[model samples]
Target: MICVGKLLGVKRRLQDMTDALSDMEAGNGNRRILAVGNEPTADLSYKMNEIVTRYEEQLSGLRAADETNRRLMTSLSHDVRTPLTTLIGYLDAAHRGVVTGKEREEYLEIARHKAHDLKDYIDVLFDWFKLNSSEFALSIERAELAELTRNNLKDWIPIFEENHLDYEIEIPERPLFAKADPDGYARILNNLVQNVIAHSRATRIKIKMKQKEKEIEICVEDNGIGIEKADLPHIFERLYKCDKGRSDQGSGLGLSIVRQMVEKMDGRITVRSEPNRVTSFTICFPVKN
Candidate 1:
């Protein structure tokens, strides 16, 4: 009789496991097999539970990704379509002779600027996609950071002057060496500076580089209507943007891309802001010996 009872217990445990697994298969992730006493099925039940937990976690991740993609589509529709429509409007007016002489020239010029803006937006979108994908690659090598930074900033001087913004660059004449992809490093600087020009309504901008023992630091500081304290922490997150008052004209991916590229090159980036006083973005890379 005792032997028969033991057989019955084993049979009961098997049935319970089957039922639990069936419930799980039928979309009930919460279903779990209860392993009571020192039964032979306890180890199997524990393993199955672990498998279910992992499956649930994977499903959650997929859901989050789906949500992010949905947000991306919404943002693309608004950011791309609005400017594109305006660009088309400007071009259409110019093409159909809606204005003539100086007015017509102005319209055409505005249309050209709009076209360039659209291209810039598209380029940033492409970079964000590439950086997030598996195919993204970096060619990191030891390079003189200070000289490379000076070369990069040369192109931006005209832009700063054009915008009537005062600028100061303080890159040391001596080479500060670090391991970085030259193109990627250039983009990082470009994006940060561009972020300042596009969003910060500041009159003065400063770019500085320094070497502190084992690390090299690059700082971009501006006196603009700065970021709010609430939005400071999330600025590096993909698709995050500050309040409309501060960031009325951006695809919201520039800083995110900067952070990703910095991390990929084994570097770090940080920001600080005091509204209407000062804002700064600093990046640090390990010094390559």
Candidate 2:
């Protein structure tokens, strides 16, 4: 009688497990096998359920990635073609002497700017691909954070003056050391500044760095048209663009790349904004002992 009871109990639990699996197979990822306590098959049931749950999560992620790729390709096609078309028109007019003298010079100048725009777009795309690839490498090194940041921002001074932008840069005199990839750090700073210049119609910009506790912090602030509250959450998302009435001059990969680079270097970034008041991006990295 004891042996018969044990066999019946096992049979009932096996049936329950089978039904749970069937529900999962039918697209109910929430279904889980009811693990029998102290039964011979309990371990197997638990492991199998864990495997099914992981599979469901991975499948969902893959579907989301696919959707993102589809949108990326769509945006890429439109962006590349629009600039290329204008560039070709300019070049063709210049070549055929459609206009001469000042008109020709103007056409060539416009063509040059368009060419540069196309190149910038292509560069961003390449960076995105390399960043997402498995074999990408970083040359990490120990460096003074303040010095590196100063070197990076020095080049932007002339640019700011040319754009009639009032800028203030404050870096602590004391050296804050960090182990990071110099190129990656430069890219992060450049992308953030470029985003502000391209999107924000701010008259003044400020970049300041400070060391606190065991970490170093950098802030890039602009007093331009700030981002909308609804768009803040998705700003770091890949291919996400805010509906802030700015022209689509960017490939929408800048902030995404910045976040990825920061993560790769064991850092974090955050942002806060008040519409038409201020927008600031803050990045923090652990200081090397």
Best lDDT goes to which candidate? 1
Model 1 local distance difference test score: 0.91
Which 10 residues in a row give candidate 2 its minimum summed lDDT?
240-249
TM-scores of all candidate predictions against the true structure: 0.91, 0.91
lDDT accuracy of residue 95 in candidate 1: 85
Candidate 2 local lDDT, 157-176, one digit each (tens): 99899789999999998889
What's model 1's TM-score?
A: 0.91
lDDT of each: 0.91, 0.90
Residues 105-173 of candidate 1 have per-residue lDDT tens digits of: 999899888888888788899999899799999999998999899889999999999999999999888
lDDT of 2: 0.90
Model 2 pairs whose backbones collide:
none
